[model samples]
Target: MDTRFLGIPELVEVPSVAVVVDVMRAFTVAAWAFAQGAEKIVLAESLDEALALKARHTRWMALKDGPPAPGFDAVNSPGLLRSVDLGGRTVVQKTTAGTVGALAVKDASLVLCAGFVVAEATARLLRRRAGDQVTFVVTGEDGRADEDLACAQYIARRTTESGTDAAAYLRRARESRAAAELAQGVRQGAHPDDVALCLEVDRFPFAMVATLEDPLMVLRPYAVDSLAD
Candidate 1:
């Protein structure tokens, strides 16, 4: 398998398998959403698209840019999903990096939205599909965020070798400037629990995969055991 890492959404292109990384929060939030019983997540390229999807599906949850709206269940924070009952509900998500990168690689043979939470499972999934060329797209903040780059590298390493230290990678990510900003947000009383939650590596056993279902890009989780070679 040929595995390569690329930074930013502009460099993202169709590949045999595209692993979109947004470790600071986006894909972490997505993994939590699935763990909380969310039926499916729809990736929206823009806040306007999320709003339109919300308008069309009254019962679905919409997460747009900025703070949590009154009617929305949560923002882009993974901590917020802890108390949400997402059973049988569809979530529409829009973020600055993760979702944008996901939408950008629409032509990929397989698209996986990844973070520390599903790092091993994502690697396992790629391992099972041997010979597939994988592109790790880091949807970094303004083109380069330490956390996302760390996650992409971690996944790449895991796919190529055994005994990858996911915890160590996460520790480095926690000390990044992007993580420091999140910690600052916590100090400012903004989703204080997110900093810890986002730093938890390999917390979930499922890998979130994206499939274009007509006009919507749907994200669903597949158990790692199911992808065994």
Candidate 2:
């Protein structure tokens, strides 16, 4: 099967199966929650809806993102998720880019969330769902991104050639090399902790997909530990 890459602007031409990434934060936290034993995740783009869902379901924990507008349960931070016990529970999460990308790809045949933390499983899922073309729609911070481009490059290279050299690409992307030029000219900066959190390669064994509930697309999380092997 052939592989192709697309930025956010080119999402419409994306194939049936798509991998949506917000690695610097959102999907990383989702991976962490899965590691902590969360059963399912419902992604709500708005805080009000997420809060309402959390209120209705006692087992759900809400993850809020973007700026701190006050009164949110928590902002987009992997550190905050460490304090919760998600075993047998559900999570209602919201992020600037992650949930939005999930919503955007609602029409795709299959759309799964991915991060550096869950790259291996994500890759396996992508291969299983491979089609004439594979798209990686990266959700960037504040309408632009630097980290997700590197992530797109990682997926494109791996899907095209098999296996990504994380350390090599990280160095090149970090140094702003020619092939790694996408890493430059970013107007946003993720938390230092977020950078560290999102950099882990395949630390978790789960993949999340979107399910519809009217206008909202809820994330349905599942364990894909077998894919890791």
Candidate 3:
């Protein structure tokens, strides 16, 4: 198995499997939504698109980072998702890094969203599922997001049967720009709780897979052991 870690600025051939990592908060929100019983999540290119999709479907909820938008149901905080009941509902989401990376990898045979919360589960799923070459897309805009790189390297090592320390990676991620911003608790929609939740390694025992369907990219949680067939 070939494991490659690529950043947003790095251009290369897409892999058979793309694991997009955004440990600051985006994928962490998706993991929390699934834990809250959300049916699925749709990735939007922008906050506007997420709102537009939610408008057409009454029950579908829209989420984004920063200040709340016109029709957004919630802010991009995993801390808030735990209290809400998302049973049988679809969540349309847009984020600065995570969703953008996910939506860009439409050509991959399999696309999985990653954060420290679901890092182990993602590795387990890939170990059992298809794909010879795996690329971990560190979705940091500048080609080097400290948080995303840590998560991607952590997950990549696990997939390659190499030993790694979750705590060590978490320590590295804490120094990231996004983590520092959230730590201040001054960002509009972001909070210290969100950063705390995002750093919980292996918090979810499932992998969030993104499947592109033309206009919409949907992410669904797949439990690792469920694919044992």
Candidate 4:
């Protein structure tokens, strides 16, 4: 299997499989939503698209670019998703890096969203589909964010290396500047528990795969066993 790691600024050539990593919050939040029983998640490329979708479907939850708006069920925080009951519901998510990166590589044979939460599951999924060229797109915020790069590297290692020190990688991610900024957000009115939630590696056992359903891009979890079959 040929696996390559590309940053956001780099053009993504369509590969057999493409995994987008946004560990700081976006993809992490999606993984938590699925873990919490969310029926599906629609990733929007922009906040306007998310708002438009929410306008047409009142039952859908919309997360904008900034803090959680009044009357919105949740924002981009994984910590806040824990309090939300997303059973049989769809979440429309728009973020700076994650969604943009996902949309950019939508043409890939398979597009998956990843974070520390589902890192192992994602790697296992890739291993199951061995012999296919894989690309890891690190969707950093503006420039290279340590958390996203670390998550991408972790996934790459897991895919190529037989044994990986997941704990060590998680420790590095926690001490990263991006992670520190997220933790500092607690003092700035960000969800106080979000930083911890994002840091919890391998929390979920499913990889979130994105599929095109008409005009929307839907993200749903796929178990490692199912993929092996």
Write down the TM-score of every candidate.
0.92, 0.79, 0.93, 0.92
RMSD of each: 2.0, 4.6, 1.9, 2.0
Q: Could you give me the TM-score of model 4 versus the true structure?
A: 0.92
User: Which residue pairs show collisions in model 1?
Assistant: none
Question: Which window of 10 residues has the lowest lDDT sum in candidate 2?
Answer: 178-187
Off by over 4 Å in 1: 9-12, 186-189
Q: What are the lDDT figures for the candidates, one per model?
A: 0.82, 0.66, 0.84, 0.81
Candidate 1 lDDT score at position 3 = 76
Poorest stretch of ten by lDDT in candidate 1: 182-191
Q: Pick the candidate with the highest TM-score.
A: 3
**Which pairs of residues collide in model 4?**
none
Local accuracy of candidate 2 as per-residue lDDT tens digits, 36-65: 777777888678888888788776677776
Better of 2 and 3 by TM-score: 3
Model 1 Cα lDDT, one tens digit per residue, 27-48: 9988988888999999987777
- Please list the residue runs of candidate 3 whose C-alpha ends up more than 4 Å from where it truly belongs after superposition: 129-131, 227-229
* Candidate number that wins on lDDT, 1 or 4: 1
Query: Candidate 3: what lDDT?
Result: 0.84
Name the better of 1 and 4 by TM-score.
Answer: 1
- Candidate 1: residue 89 lDDT (0-100): 89
Structure candidate 3, residue pairs in collision: none
